[model samples]
Target: MTGTPNTKIAFKNVRRVFGDGPSAFVALDHLNLDIFDGEFVTVVGPSGCGKSTALNIVAGLLGVSAGECRVDGDIVTGPGPDRGVIFQQYALFPWLTVRENVEFGLKLQGKEKSERRKIADHYIALVGLTDFANALPKMLSGGMKQRCAIARAYAVNPKVLLMDEPFGALDALTRVRMQDQLLETWSKERRTVMFITHDVDEAVYLANRVIVMAARPGRLQEIIDVNLPYPRNDELRLSPQFAEIRNKVWHAVYTRSGQQQPALEE
Candidate 1:
């Protein structure tokens, strides 16, 4: 993970606009970025700054209005199993049990019953949800539901993981805990990740690099590298170096957005 990590994802002069003519609202403005393979990059910005929009383009859920977005040097045309997405709301099927939800993607791929169960079980255990595998989505807490979402995303063996504020709905305590859980999962399975979040602290804590975007017609503002030691934990959050980087990102977000105060606390 040194020198150059080989660009797994690249956004070249990309632009995304909604509507047409005078009513058009530009979400992204010629934004360019490169994410290396096995790199964990977190994007943070003010509301409507195209953070999620960028992730969606990488996920192939949305097409760019201009230029191109590529994964592994190929233009992102549409969604593929190689890319997995975890949304803010846990996109689980209520009709399905926990195990079933985890296996949904595998089932879609026409995996045999036993193989689906095996992959689902492995991810369930990885996320520490083995005991709740038989439960329904309604029975799980916010944190637990998110864990299920993570397990489901990882079950398919995606090469890239796209997460859009997956822990935004959780309580402060739970959000911090989920951040650690997600890092642990990523440590074991280092997929190229593009995570979008509004929290500067979360960005600083989890990302190898924090990508800051400007508002209106969103564009890259700055890239802040988090040079902290790996295998990070809650104790790292209390470190002076961590606080410094967090504040740096906070200031960058506010400055880029022209806000007098931070939208969220670190």
Candidate 2:
């Protein structure tokens, strides 16, 4: 696949296999995709569809069996500060306060205490955690904890954000709120984001393009473009345009041939 100047994350005929021998399983098969700079892309598919595997490859946590993955024209060999990752579970340091947690990456980079405080304060306020900056992780609710995690990721100023089901663990109401909050932050930061989720509404609501994968040697099944405008809200979610795009993604994920349907919530 040819990459353009705007391509922030490029997967060039990528493949990933687990184990060695006849019993080996292929997680990804000849996947080719390019996520442009400042684009919000969401990936959705049934279970075991290499959704997380692909995110891990971009994050440099896993190696591809064939082909290559690149960030900003450089091949990814391992994890780097240029890419920030957020998972379903809030991976905050329990012993640390929100400000300290957000400053952890900067501290690791040998940033002085004063500079770390300045950067941490900015992201903490951006995520609406300014009041809770001194509170420990145990003092925050699930949604608040996730917000703190996001603040921490942004504090490092990564060019790309790889999120794997980051809102999966939250309750329904909180999940919706978190989605809006994330979009607001993204609009201001404009970082390239590759978010993986199982929810169809979320996949359509938060993405410029929704990537649907097919299981059993996971590969791309379809790419549905969400033509809706930005600054999305609850009213937009109820519109016909939103419903049409959501249905397209739903059909692409569930109606594939010879695939067992998994229990996925809309």
- On TM-score, the candidate that comes out on top is 2
- Model 1 clash pairs are none
Best by lDDT: 2
lDDT of 2 by residue, 146-208 (tens): 999999999899999999999999999999999999999999888999999989999999999
Once fitted onto the true fold, the runs of candidate 2 whose alpha carbons sit more than 4 angstroms away are: 257-266
What is the Cα-based TM-score of model 2?
Answer: 0.97
Reference-based lDDT, residue 8, model 1: 93
The sequence of per-residue lDDT tens digits that candidate 1 reaches over residues 1-266 is 21234989999999999999999999999898999999999999888889999999999999999999988888999999999999999989999999999999999999999999999999999899999999999999999999999999999999999999999999999999899999999999889999999888899999999999998989998999999988998899999999999989988989756966735564
lDDT of each: 0.92, 0.93
The Cα error of candidate 1 at residue 24, in Å, is 1.0
Provide the lowest-lDDT 10-residue window in model 1: 1-10
Clash counts per candidate, in order, are 0, 0
